[model samples]
Target: MSLALVLDLFGTFFFAVSGSLLAARRQFDIVGSLFLGSVAGLGGGVIRDLVLGQVPSAFDRPVYLIPPLAAALVVFFLLGSVERFRRLLLVFDAGGLALFCITGTVKALEAGMNPAASALLGVTTAVGGGLLRDVVANREPQLFNRRDLYAVPAMLGAGLVTVLWHAGMFGTAAALGVAAVVFGLRVLSLHYGWHIPRAAGTWHGSRRE
Candidate 1:
């Protein structure tokens, strides 16, 4: 019933939607759609929990896994109606990204990790699912090269949470504020075509060999 848990659940729902949208777009079967949705919803948290030496809640908690799989099923049954809202799913993914980062950091702190380590784990929790999604989808992860400020925003938010926690400002307000900043950065980057610097003289993806 805590606000953090609320955000986490909401994040799971939206990210699941995003995954379901992708699966539909790719014409994946029902099983594949469900697999992607579950991965997008719970993959990051699972990695984070494993790293912290805790049992992943999604493994036993139906609440964490149900929403995503249900979403996938919804999309499977109602493809035409759902596909129109595909664009909105990216926004949902961004929200999920921000929530997961903050929640991950907070959870790491609760698990006795130092601020720095907690922040790093936060980034891991925020992006692990997306990475897995892309890999399983047989596409390159979007975080590679200079693909807009994705992971960097997660890092920034995590860093902010660490600093605020260290400064005795650890509270719901602080966490929400930091998450908003990260989410805003991601939105602005998408709007303005902002991108990080890539390696010198390196081509992304392919060079048309």
Candidate 2:
């Protein structure tokens, strides 16, 4: 019923869809799709909750389970149609990234975490699921991809949420605004091939190898 819960559910759905899409692309069966979807939807929150010494909502609250299951079912049944949009996975991932960063930061703050720790947890919440999904799927995680700007956008969003909360300006409008900014940045990064620079010698070393 709360806005935060609504945003969390939506984020879970988006991430789950991305996971299912990846599974479909890789020719994974329904069971695999469901597994990946659940991981991508709830893994981040689980990590965060564990770190905070709390039970993960995904397990404690049954409502948190619906989105991943729904997403897996939808993608499993409509793989053909969904495959036409090659970028849908990235788009949904971006949506999840945006929403999770905000909600994660808010929750951390609510749990009495400092601003710095909360922002870091927010970044974790945004990218943890995708990282696990990719690792389990035997693919490269975007967090380490040189040409992909994944964690930067998440950090920005989380930092903004932290700043706004500190300023006592965080609310529905601010949360939505922050999410929009993060989502737009993520999409643009995907579109324009924006990326954070690697270590000074890493690229050159790879070239020599």
> Which candidate comes out best when scored by lDDT?
2
lDDT of model 1 at position 96:
79
Off by over 4 Å in 2: 201-209
Best by TM-score: 2
Candidate 2 structure quality by residue, lDDT tens digits, 27-112: 99999998999999999999989989999999999999999999999997887776888799999999999999998999999999
Lowest summed lDDT across 10 adjacent residues in model 2 is found at: 200-209
The per-model lDDT (C-alpha) reads: 0.82, 0.93
Q: Write the per-residue lDDT of candidate 1 for residues 1-209, one digit (tens) a residue.
A: 88778877877776787777787778888888888988988888999999999899798677887778777877777777756764566676788789889889988988889988999999998888777777788766766737567898899988988888878997888878987998899888887889876565446664432
TM-score of each: 0.88, 0.96
Q: How many clashing pairs per prediction, in order?
A: 0, 0
Root-mean-square deviation per candidate = 3.1, 1.6
Assess candidate 2 and give its TM-score to the true structure: 0.96
> Model 2 scores what on Cα lDDT?
0.93
